[model samples]
Target: MSPFSLPSKPLHLALLGLLLFLLPFAILRERSYVTIDDNLDTEISIPYLLTRYHVALDYRPTAVVPPVMNGLPRNAMRSGLSVTVAVFALLEPLPAYLVHQALVRVLALLGMYALLRAHFLKRDNDKALAAGLALAWAVLPVYSMYGMSVLGQPWLLLAFLNLRQGRSRWTDWALIAGFPLWSFFVFVGPFVLVALAGLLLWDWQQGRGISKRVLLGMALLTILYLVVEYPLLYSLLIAKQFVPHRVEFDLGKLGPQTLAAQLKSAFLYFVTGHYHASRFFRGAAVLAVGAAFLLTPAAKRRAVLRQVLPLLVALAVVALFCGFAQQITDSLQRVIPPLRTFNLSRFHFLTPLLWFVVLVLSLRWLTSRKLQAAFIALQLLIGLGMNAEWLNNLRELAGRPLPDEPNYQAYVAPSLFADIQRYTMENAGPPALYRVACLGFPPSVAQLNSFYTLDSYQNNYPLAYKHEFRPLIAGELAKNAALRTYFDDWGNRCYLFSAELGRNFRVSARQHQQVQDWAFDAAAFQRLGGRYVLSAVQLQAPARSGLQLRGVFSARTAYWRVYLYEVVPSSSPKPGAAVGQKLPEISKFGLLVCKNG
Candidate 1:
């Protein structure tokens, strides 16, 4: 039946599903702050993005403009926030993270409303049901209590929403999809582009006429994307010096067993909330939906199977195309000529795009009341489990024993991050800038740097491959001297690329000093930009753990040249230098405590 004619039960299911999806975020609103990852995007990157092109600043030459948190690039992705920040800058530096989260929530709700209303909400009962479901989903307590990016997801959702509505040919789809992708190099840009191409190809293969209007629409897509990214794009091309090349991944040589393992990990990734804290419930809910589809009555099933088959085939195609570990590795290597600095991770936004389609199909399957109820029950169970999981996570954050990754503190925010940020910025004098490398650990802190790097974790996910960088990608990145400079290890101001370090940076005062001592000066620390002096004390050890040298003693510190190298060798013969001078060995003992005055 047409979406408009969906029965009461089916409509209820749609709304209920949406609410269920939203429930975690809504219920945990108080706890809702930007996760460290999101912060890296909106909070940290906003200032840098503004300064790069919009505002008059020294604009340090870096690998790319619109700097990123961690390894993720945030250069061209701040279009949505440019105006917001500009307004905030007028008042004061309002926390862009909060703004980002709020905006994302609104976008998510709107997208969900539009999706359900378009697909299921027909009569009064359906509307009520849809509202309930959407709310429940939106605020499900099972997801992380505080995080951002829900809004970002909806931009991609809108693109799919357009496609679902048979308006896939609309130029607006490309523009809408590209907007988010361009803004957050981590989420959906390249994936949306891939999805766009797929839709366009499908239409073309179906013999749909490519009208001048359509071609112009396509041109509009390009124009709009470039417009949004005009500033950053200009920097990369003119100032950054773009290069293009390819990088290779020997995935084919990874033997069948390793390949299978990677595939299983990827599959389990979506099937379970293995990595994502919010969508854990989605796994069981999707399974229940799958079961419901399988159990349909023969006649109804046959009718539905027509739709189901294409969807399943479509899913398989997308999954095969987007799935696998090496896909991302390759995507990062493939560069589009001048856009060498582009990241493949930006295509990850497509995961939500594909999932949106899957969710709609599941909701459509709820045309039957029994199935809808079963699915709802599954959702509720998942939600409950998710809540428990998060609570456990929080408890672990509070110094309780954790079952896994005992480093829960690594991902969670600490009180010190803000203080550290204040100190770093306030103290960093002219030409002395703060450059942080954000990995996906906190997922939110990477947006703080002048330029971010590619999160190695993202090297494994989907849509990650579509932008596969070849020599084309690398050569392009090489051309951008600014982008190259960001990667230079010239400063003491480097942030470790992980969530653990981010949270710890804020929580552990000593660690913060170790960081500062390694990178900045004591005077800079005291006067820290009129902000609090956030210092860390670091005790470095061989990254290779459990190695005990019988004769040699090792001292690990950022001041390697002075502390370790300058020390008189205690009757130890200096080893001959190879192609590279090897770091001196000092770890003879099992453990040693060395303190700095």
Candidate 2:
């Protein structure tokens, strides 16, 4: 059959295309809204990639990227969104997340259709069954919310579809390897390996030996990836070197309670109604499909089981993976703190999908053709209603509020970021030179500067950064620069090297960590390459020190009086002999000091 002929019916084809076209706008009625992670990663990664390719703003001058951070520029530093943004770089700025989700959903629906159609054709079953199963899975009431990147649900189904076809291509293998990079695959790869083995076993039983071409094709692709990324792979993996103070990894949502909750959540996540509201009746209906299979005759049961056994094995493998991932035992949770949520069930993406088509087939017991047609229509309606609910929920979430760091009424959007961005652009030298540092917070708001900053926040940090700034990581470096005090808050780590700060205004301790307050040793700040310090609080210059009072950005009218101070490099002192005097403990001023400054 020609690839175009897979839909088999004109109405099926039209609805599929129409749904794909509408999903982005429907689900993303949130406008250009973004989650903290989505806004942070996409804003940084898209520009980062485009800049490296010389297409967007340049970040190389002050990017401070570690070796691990540079693994694949075209990978665009996103999960599934990487493939989308790379393919359509032009769409990176506008609605990229929305567009990426739309594409993933489309692939999932179409892939389902193809996989089931192929199986049905071989067994001489009705192709409409394939269409109905594909439609049911497409709207199954679970998504990652941040972006489709974390939702491997669709991608897993698509991978199985590809496996069913048993065809090998270089591009296909390349994509399969990179599809879930850096996040879900970090811990989910083991179970997928088991599923792949199951596929191979089924094919062998069917008289098709392993395709050696796939083995060689994948081997060649592996060699190509390794050769292309030898420098990065060698530095990060072999030498254990990494970009210093850039990315960091902190254990998220740990402990037995978290694991237990996650297990319960995964089970509930599967049978949430079409509207994603609890419908235990529908869930029970799903289980009843299995009982129907049990009631089949000796001959029909055997034939169906042959096709379904592989899926069962695949499902079992993933179920075991999901269970292990939750660290079910108290001792295990102490060490592994699974990343998937009790609420979202993100890691169990493929579990529900594996045997869903079996249920769809079992529903075909209505003797009259009219009754069966009505049943199909009802399933499609349920899927659509669920999709409608999902869209409305997204709208509600977006309309509520963008989260402020803490519950300070000072708006996170339109104010905190807007004020910071305005002050930095007006003062931070030029686009190509100079970096801005937030004296208190770790550039969370400053990141919206959308270009370069001396601020950093990431989940994986290099060992070198830890070693060089041991005091900061250990939360020890106190005095003269309380910068270490600000490196962390709620387990997220943010670091930026002072060397990456800028070339001008030399100082001691090439970097400074965040501090308890904006007041760092003013004289020490100058030596540390801080040209402009945006203080969350107002401060008088370390009276009599080299610190000069610059314009106060967004003064008394705002929630806090944000003060901007210029670091005055001490004039080469006249032979008077007062080198670096203790410029009074301006506690009333900005009471603080910089690291070793």
Candidate 3:
């Protein structure tokens, strides 16, 4: 065959087709690393192990790094981050995350295809139009903002599609069983159940039911799936540790108005792409198409009736589930209105999906093919532009350590591994493991270098850190100094939730002085393996930290300074002893110019 000739073999052609299809995303991935969303946590997992639970991989309530849940420090069976870490380990390395994202993109695209084909595109003039709209759905760039942490989405889509088409029995069981593994997708189960019920009604109206045996099998499978995943379900719903790791949420007062508002905002989140409302244009674009759709012929509407009915069915089912869940959730948590929960954006998937259905339907109705093509092209461009920052930052990170700055950027301290190993490791004492708490640099920097840091700002950390020490930091617990002392003593042993809370020996609270955002204690500075502190703020090293300033790394062009310190415990605290060091007792703090400004 000539070089220009297309491949004749089926496998080769398939490969060629896939290559061409994925090229744009590949370039985007190359220029950018995935950031934000659940990716922020999963990225830590790329280099994680149960053994170290290194400060970088801190996202659990256990006082111990790997989360000694229920007092089992040896049991490394926590979900969420652990699942992400295993995925990273299996996939191999840094860019492999991008691969999983790409796969999710493909899965989502195919899902859009299935949804389109069985509904809107069934009677369209051009069959290829379904794929084009599906492509639009795929390239929304929301993934960049959200990251592909919810591994169960594709499974959810598969389950919905299978039930919609009345696909094989085996597939339904697999999807049903698989979804509970990712809790975010489990929420879709109730939606799926409601949809399936509607599907049975429609089928019965057409003189066919979902088949009593198959329905029974599905019901059984759902129960078994829950049974299999009950431990995780219990943890997510009941355990405060897993609920509000990163963000704060409150149960709205139980009322129709609150439900209506949440329901409305939930839909709005889909258009705006959550976070910063990055995809507002996407929402607008969908609305414009919907508006133009109003002008179409009354007679031609029959073709779209096929599309609208199923779409509405899906929407109604999802909406009802969301409304019910919202009301029930508020009712359940009403007693503790101040209690926090995860982001409610978990229910926002249906809005974009409805948008997808309508956009495709509108495209089919348009008489001007140029207008149709233009509309899709415009959306594709806007979506890409909206998400350019994700790619741009990724590229910057990949090609950084620029000498003009000769400094770290964003949440990076790539060279800290060598810096700490050289400076702090060689001189440090036994228990060989030492933690390096960070001040100036991002929390991720400490993890990147494989250091233990109690100052971890990750989504998950020991609740005791937030509950006990946080109040002290905010002066909420200062009313009773004894309580602060108790918590200070508890902070070290707070990693595990068990009856033997005070039995474990740990260092007492050391004197802490917060100058700017920096907070640490001379005693904690020593006990939690505080050999070195990498901070951007320049300070007169207090003799109390036992943290002598070993070295300061920076370049003339650099805008920041990274100070490293060495620490040692001159003497040990008494077994199971407790002490609290208030800020007043510590030396006065003065801030210096650690930045170029």
Candidate 4:
């Protein structure tokens, strides 16, 4: 009869498991290998730059982070009003990241548990099942930088369901209002709102009158998102600042051209889900759902099919759209101008919550407690296996750290870059006086170390800046067709591209690759205020490229052998002389020409 018995015990154990799961990350700290794709390469730097520069709340159109892209607009980063930004501002990078991860997991666990207990599994025995499912959902290795956009869907659904039934309390309204502060608008808000709108229409079609409370809740959430994301709104709608590089986004050129490739992509999405939302292997969940449906009595099968078929169809539609997104957007943009850059494929973001919802519904049908427990255990293992942090920690624990996969210390190489920064300042003056570019590694590494960089991996930046920076990498792009498509078509990572390195940005000291036939435009680089190149690999024949090897710095714990190359003073082009004239013109890609040229 005690409050801490039965379901509460499982919930408590789940919390303990969550802590144990995160313990390695906390203990290892900077030595842990976190996900790098869209994470360490891009999102991690945004918070650090915003906080370090004291520009977290700066909303001026001109506000910029000088460390990246010679002044990446402040709006390009996540909104300063977010809880994620606050955490980063209050703590150091590594601690803030770990704390955010813990916060997200805890919130996810409690939110899913509360939702299931109140709505779906109110029975005494079902509470334990609910707790187990909540644990599996919580451990999903979604990008924490996205905050609750994926994991918080349960809370949103709970609040909306309460409102629709006209039994909502103050807590439901509070959830509707408070959710925006922790979640991203672009990532999940629009899709959530659209889904809510569809539900309202569906309710009306079913002869249920529209719920005024539900509409009000939706409105409150939308208004709060607009307020929280004010800077983004200002940039896109009001500021009318320089055109963003997204304006030149050519999805047709970027997406799969063949029908077979598109279908394959859709199938992968349907089964494996997207990486951003946590690619928790869905095989077990799918099997469980199929078994539950088949086990249903023949008389009740029609009703069950009616309930689940819509979700399955919706999942298929999202997958197909995402797979063929490039071609669809290319055609749709002709009629809808915003479709050119706006990612409609984010509908896939809803799949994680949907898959779990189906699993929960399927579990409800299975009467045997042992069968349900086995399914939950299998799902927990699958979720844990997909998590890179967990996998890396296991590898570290086993004493077989992947040489190519660098831990946080080695990946960021703070000590190595600190030495580079000190040597550069001691000789070339403060980093503020000159910009640097990365050759074989991500520019984010330089940005994280407080180096002023001429390059960055930004989702949004000025189109004019992209053109101005293209000349520096034009030769490399001309040599490699794939690199050309990546930059000219997608252009998210406006980095220093090299033909020898191709598109591989994570070249570590372990790789003995050298750029032998380096074709660099030092004059163009200098014109952009670039004075040094921090390469991971040695640039053979540096003198021929108008670069003087300043120093070869190395550290025992660092993953990169910092090859410092300074632009020779005489490499600055003479007035009126063409820079990178032998290389492809920016106009060849139907892009604006650099005004300086």
lDDT of 3: 0.44
**Candidate 2 TM-score, C-alpha based:** 0.58
423 Cα displacement, candidate 2 (Å): 3.1
* lDDT of prediction 2: 0.40
Give the RMSD in angstroms, all C-alphas superposed, for model 2.
Answer: 10.7
The per-model lDDT (C-alpha) reads 0.37, 0.40, 0.44, 0.83
TM-score of each: 0.55, 0.58, 0.64, 0.94
lDDT (10s digit) by residue, model 4, range 1-597: 211124488788888888888888877877887788889988998989999998999988667776777667677678888899999999988888889989999989988998888888888777678888888999988999899889988888889998999976888888899899998788798999988998899899999989999999999999999999888777767766556788788889877789999999899899988898778778767878777778877787777677767887888888998999888899989898777878888888899988887788777877778888999999999999888778987787677888888888888988899999999989767778778999989988888888988889888877888888899888889999999999998899998888888888988887877999777888888777778999988988988778999998889999889899999868754665433331123222211221122
Model 2 worst lDDT run, 10 consecutive residues: 587-596
Model 2 Cα lDDT, one tens digit per residue, 37-131: 32333343433444344433222212222212211122213232235435345554334545555655555566566545544333334566556
Ranking by TM-score: 4, 3, 2, 1
Candidate closest to the true structure, highest lDDT? 4
Give the range where candidate 3 is weakest over 10 consecutive residues by summed lDDT. Answer: 588-597
lDDT of 4 at 109: 91
Runs in model 1 lying further than 4 Å from the true structure: 1-33, 37-95, 120-124, 136-186, 203-218, 238-257, 272-281, 321-348, 367-374, 380-535, 538-597
lDDT of 1 by residue, 1-597 (tens): 122243355445544554444444344443332333333323444454455444422233332232222112223234433344444444322243334334444444445555566554544545544544444344443212122233344444444445544565444455453453324333334454565667667667778743344444445545666665555555445553222111223232331236677676455445443233244534644564466467766667776656545555665444443345344444444443322223332233344334444554566556665555555455545554655434543454354633332221232323334333444445433212322222112223323322222222222111211132112123323544432232221111123222123333333221233221122221221111111111122324311211111121112211111111111122222355210122111110100111010
Q: Each candidate: RMSD to true structure? A: 12.9, 10.7, 11.1, 4.4
Worst 10 residues of 4 by lDDT: 588-597
- Candidate 3's residue-wise lDDT over 465-529, tens digit each? 34422421333224435334433422322221111112221111121212322223446444332
Enumerate residue pairs that collide in model 4.
none
